[model samples]
Target: MNHEHKISNWDLIKNGLFGENTIFRMAISLCPAIAVTTSLKNGFLMGAAVLFVQTMVNITVSLLRNFINPRIRIPVFMLIISGWVSVTDMTMAAFAREAYRQMGLYIQLIVAFASILARAEMFANKNKVVPSMFDGIGMGLGFMFALVVISFFRELLGRGTIWGYEIVATKPLLIMLLPTGGFFAVGILMAFFNWIDIRFYGGKGAGGAGGH
Candidate 1:
């Protein structure tokens, strides 16, 4: 059998969004996905913010990779990421004060999100600017996709709404809004995705803690 090795941008993006998703498939970054996805809107906004952060950080990190020393690469990466996040934090505070307030410390916590760091160290550190940027877009979409999935279910069942728009009318599954419920909701979804992978892909899918 002849081996074929061809990769396209679409494949990369799709892999990041679905095949290698940080939430369902990879199971990484569930904390933010679960914590902030109280509503569909909140989940969307959080995803947007993360997407912006990831793209900028990836580009910048890739640009500076050669300049950073191995001994202090992590700290340097943190500084760069935190600086960008601070800018984003301030921008949000100034323009979207309500959202800023809604996000609170979580916005600041973006600097420490392992997803961003992982991209910096793994992909951005070695890849060129364009590829790093694409990676950011892919990973960001994946992260957002996961958040939206979890939030969609949580909102519909927990509040009878989607993106604050009334969908189902009932008392609602109030537990979905609580912290414990977040875990259960996301866990069940993850298991389902895994099960699907096992059935269709022979159990060979991208396996990791999802997020480091």
Candidate 2:
């Protein structure tokens, strides 16, 4: 879709949140999504870090799009992404020490996220600054939303708690906190979202994970 020419700003936001969600729809960056989502606290912290890096990277990429050489654009994008990721890393280290201790690795991992890099190449590089900023917000929020949903179920089912607060008297499914459980959660949620798309939005369904 030619989002720059045809789609409205609000639609771009919705598109990222639902139509092209990072987890349930796009399926990119599943590694971090699954890894950090075993706990609600980790999931939220990682999502927040990603949100900051993604928005800043998009804004930086959009501003530098014209000046970047086509042959070196990929490297330039990585530089921009890493720069933002480092900023987040140091900022959190100084301010949010406890959270940084929990999520420092994932924050650094944001530099390699396919979804963030894809937006820089596909959307931000071609779109104007304002739209790119909103697109970043949308994509970041979509990712954060996915992490929250997955972590919500995982934590509640596995530990019977939400953010370390007790909910159920007993663990509903202990395996839900394991890595294998992450796969199950992602798969089930992916299907659920695809069903929603087909049933309500008349969508063909979720596309392959590799494509944008």
Candidate 3:
């Protein structure tokens, strides 16, 4: 692994949360973002699962970076990711059985999330432990935040509910609960954030180096 740029821990966190947000900014992991985000409860649990796995994988990879051969780093990263994803899967299955029933496979699928591997390779492997941890937190939080936002709107507008609790007598937009609406939600949110990035932040999309 190659050492990348050095920045304050806070900056790394902000970068993961905003500059390189996995869904809204970096545009990664849209499968879960769409499939599991039809409801707020689903979205939150899925995001939580990813957050744990992503953070742990980053820490593990950073710890073993020097020991891993560059030629085999990808396989090593996958192994590390699968190990953590399994932990997340079983933990959720044990404690959050109902939600786990709905998203169990997706939880297992976290092992394949490109964002996790990207972070391990591009940021964590090249950074120190504390910084890598913060980076993981940032990225995980950003991903969770994006899912929460999308699912909030999706659940609210589509089902007239929040986290499965009814808030209205009638459904607002049924389509929002469907895959087409998932694309609509992701696209709209992505553009909205992109506009914010350009209008206020002078715009730098989360590039390959910025995302994980």
TM-scores for the candidates? 0.89, 0.94, 0.93
Candidate structures ordered by TM-score, highest first = 2, 3, 1
Give all candidates' CA lDDT scores: 0.81, 0.88, 0.87
> Which candidate model has the greater TM-score, 1 or 2?
2
**Each prediction's RMSD to truth:** 3.7, 2.1, 2.4
TM-score of structure candidate 2 = 0.94
Best by TM-score: 2
Q: For residues 1-212, could you state the per-residue lDDT of candidate 2 as single tens digits?
A: 36465777787788788878988887899999888998998898888888888888889998988999989999999999999999989998999898778778888889899999999999899987888998998899899999999999999999999999999999999999899999999999999987877788777778633333
* Residue 46 Cα positional deviation in candidate 2, in Å, after optimal superposition: 1.1
- Per-model tally of clashing residue pairs: 4, 0, 3
Better of 1 and 3 by lDDT: 3
Off by more than 4 A, model 3: 1-5, 204-212
